[model samples]
Target: MRLAWFSWLVRNFGGYGFSDGPLRAAIGAGAVLLTAFLVRITLHRHRPAAVAAAGLTCALGFGWLAFH
Candidate 1:
């Protein structure tokens, strides 16, 4: 099952292996920061932004590759 792999991933891989791992945590943190930054700069709520999310995905992808 998927849960089995996830649990194994967590057990072997450190914090990043968890569902709320540092990689994703970083992503979420980045997104929130990006959103706030956008609001401050644009003063708009509907403004679209993908900077933080992209950075997060790249970081996590690299890290996963490195470990594997």
Candidate 2:
């Protein structure tokens, strides 16, 4: 089932599915960033380090997964 869905995505999309992986990763990273933003807002503290750490972590993870 999962394979079928992925195949469909690859067929309907373009570039031999290369774009699909990054697109999905970007979406997931966006969600994580949004969650981090919400957490920072709820805490009511100017935690720049935390935000930067989260952003960097997400970017590294996305890069690793999307490029690996």
Candidate 3:
């Protein structure tokens, strides 16, 4: 799963109209890091229901991204 996510990142780097590869990669990495940090905090502080909701939200987000 981790490898696939990294592969997707690499394949989609500079996909948002950014011409510089390194800058795009950095932005992507930062976004992933920020998401991880937020999820970690949510898991630590929130209830299981909240965690499940977060996971579901992420899945729906990825599904939207995949299909559209």
For model 3, residues 1-68, the per-residue Cα lDDT tens digits are 99998998668754633335566545654564566457756777667766776666666544443343
For candidate 2, the 10 contiguous residues with the lowest summed lDDT are 12-21
- Best model per TM-score: 3
lDDT of 2 at 57: 62
Q: Which candidate number maximizes lDDT? A: 2
RMSD from true fold, candidate 2: 9.7
Q: Estimate each model's TM-score.
A: 0.35, 0.39, 0.40
lDDT of 2 at 66: 47
Per-residue lDDT tens digits for candidate 1, residues 1-68, read 99998787668655443355677756765665565555445634433444444445556654664344
Per-residue lDDT value at 51 in model 3: 71
- Look at candidate 2 and tell me the lDDT of residue 17: 26
Lowest summed-lDDT stretch of 10 residues in model 3? 59-68
Q: Candidate 1, which segments miss by more than 4 Å at Cα?
A: 1-19, 44-68
Prediction 2 TM-score vs. true = 0.39
